[model samples]
Structures are given as structure tokens and as C-alpha cells.
Target: MPFYSCFAHSLIQNGYHYSRKSPWTASQNIAAVESLGICHSFVLHCIISSFPGLPLVNPIPTKSLEGKSLIIRVFIEQFYENLEEATIGRWLKAEGDRVGDQEPLVEIITDKITFELPAPGSGVVRSIISREKSVVPVGCVIGLLGEPDDPLPDVSAENRATLERRQREVESQALIPSPETVAPEASVSERVRDRGKVRATPAARRVARENGMDLAEVAASIGGGLIQEEDVQRWIERRGSST
Candidate 1:
């Protein structure tokens, strides 16, 4: 079934009298003619976002324009040539929060690296369609942006087709990464060992031994996490020039 049909049915089942077609007046709002305490614009936005690449169509008529929208669609650049999918790592900004242009709102992790999704334009995050840890394709609608009072846009058929066409073009240019391009990873034990290793100058080691102090202890006491001759001297000095 079409997304609008399914959503309309749900609303109607819940006692909402959705208009059969676009109509004018608040009582004839698209989704909730008799609904109360519900932001009709937000509901419409949610429904339209559920259907990717589909225009945000408001069959209902309104007195004014649809309103300004600042959409931040997922766009894979040429640098992401071989990546087909990524997992949502985290959301730095929540829905309804104001965001500055180019500010990172969400973190997405691919096989190679974790990157932040920057805001396309300064606006509020009206909706977060993509949830954390959900892996999705490259060109899907991950989230929505809009002004404080901006009503949901009526996505035209032509705009929907254009978005899909662009997505296809991006996929056509995708390439597979060379095996050598993959970086070597360190195992847990290796990482622990690397962290446990103490770096100290030869003079620092001698000073530590002469003062009955271990380099490990010196490293633990110092803020740098690395032991040095001056660190040992400072430790000795702090200890009244003795062990």
C-alpha cells in the first residue's frame, strides 16, 4: 500500500477524520480533521519521511505557502567511493534543537572511519528518522530539518524522481576498495601491552633505581603518563630528596 494510504488508515482507525482529498481550512486539515492536541504539520512530515524519495505532498489546501524547509539528506561524496552503507553511531543534537550551519549533528561509522553528518543549513532538527546503530544505505533520508514554524513541504513528483536519479548516479560511481587500502588492526592484548609499556630515558631509569623508585611508579604519579629524569627528580624532591 502507499505510505499515505497506510498512515491515513491508521489515523482514521484512531478516530481521526482525515480528509478524502486536499481541502482548505483547519477543520479540513489533511490528516486530522477532528484530531486535537496534535501538530498536524509534524504528523505530515513524519509520514512523508517514512517514504524515501517521495515528495512531501500536502493534498490539503492551505491559505499560505507550505513554508521554508532545510532538509539534510544523506549525500555520499566522491571520497566515499567504495562505501555502500554506514551505521549511525550517535546523535550530537536531538530533535527540536537549534543547529548552526555546518555543525555536526550525527556520527556515522563506515568500515574505514567514523564521520559526522554536518547540518546543511542553520535550522532546527525537526525529526530524526534514522536511529542510532541502524545501518542504512548511502542515499536514504536519514533525518529532517526545518524552520521553527515551517510546515512540511509538498514533495513534488519531479523532485522525488530527481532525488532517486541522483542516488542511482552515486551508486553507479561506487567502487570496491583494494585489499591493501585496509588498515591493519591491533588485537586487544597488543593494545593493552602497548599501553602498559613505560617510556623513560636511561638517566630517568638510573635516578628511579637510585631513589628506590620504579619507573612504573613514576609514570603513575606523573600526569604525562611517561617517566622522565625530571619527573623522577621532581618526585624525589617532592619526597624530601629521599625515597
Candidate 2:
């Protein structure tokens, strides 16, 4: 009997089968198996030991892996020495939103300083473990992301805890008369654009921050004069008119 016939007989006895695209020849099937790291020596031993005159192979190629996967996770890092935890001050991108390179995904607060937490790669934000005002331990999973077409994965237990914490925070936020619930998305974009080093008094700065006005540009409206609270108001009116 031929080597292939003996191999086929052994495969049937062992309850193993091989398949490939149609129009594949016997030679093509063997080549494909060899490409997948099935060495001739191993093949002859396992599937055709009874046969004789099998050609010996020079070397066995490394196995080619299957099932490539992608992963995306955002962690709370140690921004300062001896920092143990960080607070999720706010979220810049909502769930399911696609973030590009260097884009801020969330705002984190540590030691009373706010910092932008940027995305590591361009991908869709699939899940948020921590919500605004929620505290998370350093190196914990605070968010998840993946390709736009990738299926949402089941979150880990650590993520589940953060989600629950967000729910509680939401309930607490509901008790306050905060305007964030009704703020328009455009206003949020404007706020992100307005951030940077700017010259303004604390009161004027607060007003500008509240209205999403860039103090850096708002100061130009004053022509090198002191940016007061009234100056910020005027700038807002000017911005409203320009729109």
C-alpha cells in the first residue's frame, strides 16, 4: 500500500480527520500539514508506522499559531511618588466612542491636580469601569477598548466593582442640581479646546472654566488688560454673537 493509504488507514483508526479547501491534491494536503508543523518523522510514527519507504524530513518547522487576538485596557497609574490611588475626576469620551492617538479618554485627579488620561491606541471605548468621582486603585482596570467591529467582552470582576461604584455615584449626583445632565455635547467640546496656560484672575478663570471659554484667547479680547470676571462675561457674549 502507498504511504498515503497507510496514513489514511491509521487516521481512521485513531478517529482523526483532515480537511482543506476543495481542489486540494494529496501532495497539497501533505504540504499544508507540514507547514502546520507536522514533521514527517512524527507523522510516520503516529499515522503510518506500519508503512515502509517513507521519506525522512531534514528538519521540523516551528508551529504556526492560530487565533490571533487584540486587547485594550486603561489603567490607573502612579502619577506621583508613593501615590496609592487616583480619582476619576471626569470622562472625556463616553462608552462606544472612538478615540484617536493622543486623545484624552478621561480626566484623573491625584493630589488635587487634574491630568488627562490618554488612550494608548486608536480604538472604540467599549466599557468604563470607573465613572466620574469614583476612586480606583493604582494599576486597576478603569476602562476597556477594542476595534470598532470587535465584540464587547465580558468584563472582569474588578471592572464590575467599578461599574457598581459608578451607579452609586450617579445616585448621589442625582441629589444635586448639577447642570451636567443637561449640558450639550458641543459645549463639552468647547471646554476641551479652552484648556491650556492662560492669564486670568481666579474669579475670571472660574467663570471662563464654567463657560468653556479659552482664557488664552479670551485675554486677547482685553488687549493685554487684566482679565476680570466681567471680561470673561464679555468674552462669552462675544463668542455667543460670533456663533
Candidate 3:
């Protein structure tokens, strides 16, 4: 059965109206439906499937210009449940470039990984709202798309303020080592261990000790270098340190 048909039938069977507006929010509605033992993904799928004409996942409809055309607002889609913000790595298509539906548009980097976000629909890239390396909250508009002649829609102050707030929060948070802090795969090298000491040069050893970093860990990270002061400095940068 089609998702909307099956879901509507289930709701009707449980004494709910498909077209009637409920007092509950969307999340509340989902939760209420799930109480009937429906799978969460299935319920969410049905909700999205019901909206065939709407680009609810990534595009927001801008105010129709004289009722002629609607602009698509491109946003950073949330790929992970726990991810709230991401950095705009770079834009593949700049303003005025024609793009097809689902073409790779921009690179987005989260704490876990970097991935390309696709264009929501076919149109010319009308405006680039967020620049490269900007840290924006998920669902924040990073660009806009429409016909080449369409006027650029104004981004509301509220949305820009929200992005600013998220950036500030991220900046004020304490630094911590993330998965990217360490190399993903170990390289080929024997552990530089000798007489209960990490086999590092004097300068490397001195720098590591002063920074309170373990030289063995540094040796293991690089895999083959004879651990130099430069190596320690690079490691510090990767570790999110200013020193």
C-alpha cells in the first residue's frame, strides 16, 4: 500500500481524522501515532510521503514574488540526530550557476565527517547566504535558488540572529579532542620504545614534555617520523591548541 494510504487508514481505524488539524505540534502528533505501536521511521516516512509537493526536508519556500515564482531556500540538512550545527566547508556552485536537482552544491563538515550537501531542486544559484567555513545551525539557510531573473529574497533578521547565537555557543564551549584528533588508520611503524622511554630526539622530547603531551602517543600517531619539534607542533594544532 502507498505510505499515505496505509497510514491514513491506520489513523482512521484508531479514530483520528486525516485532514483535521489537531491541537498537537508535529512532534507531538508523531509521538501520539507511535503510541499505537507504529515504527518511528515508518510514521515519519508517511508524514513526508504525504507532502508530495512540498520540499520539507531541505527547502523552505520563500515569499512568492508577485505570485509568479517561489524561491527555494537551501539549508544544511541534519544527517545525524545529535548534530545541531556544522561548518560550511565550501560551495561547489556559486551564485548564478545553473544547478540540477540533487547536484552536489556545498560541502558541510560536522564533528564526525565531511559530506557534500545537494541542491534541493533545479534552478540557478540565486544567492550565497553563508560563506565558506561558516559554522551554521542545521536548518539555517546557506543559499537560495530560483530563476536567473528572480530577485533575491531577504533573509530575516531572526534567522541570521539564530546563526550568530549558535556560532557564539560553539566558540564559548570548552575544547575537547574529537575523533579527528587521531589518525583514522594506524600507519606501518614499530613502536619507538627503548629502556622505558619513547625514542624521540632531544628537541621533540623537550617540546612534548613542556606541553605535557606523551611522546609515545606522538610517535604512534605519525607512525614513522623520528619525532621532531615540528611534529609536536603539528600535533598541537590537530589537538585544537593555540600553543
Say which candidate scores most in lDDT: 3
lDDT of residue 176 for candidate 1: 53
The C-alpha stretches of model 2 lying farther than 4 A from their native spots are 1-67, 151-155, 158-243
- Residues 1-76, candidate 1: write the lDDT tens digits: 5755765565555444444353333212322321222332334533443443332223333322333233433333
lDDT by residue for model 2 over 62-81, one digit each (tens)?
A: 32212212335577766777
Task: List the candidate 1 regions with Cα displacement exceeding 4 Å.
Answer: 1-79, 153-243
Model 1: per-residue Cα lDDT at residue 152:
48
At residue 143, what lDDT does model 1 achieve? 70
| Candidate of highest TM-score | 3
**CA lDDT, every prediction?**
0.57, 0.60, 0.65
Show where candidate 3 strays beyond 4 Å. 1-66, 161-243
Per-residue lDDT of 137 in model 3: 78
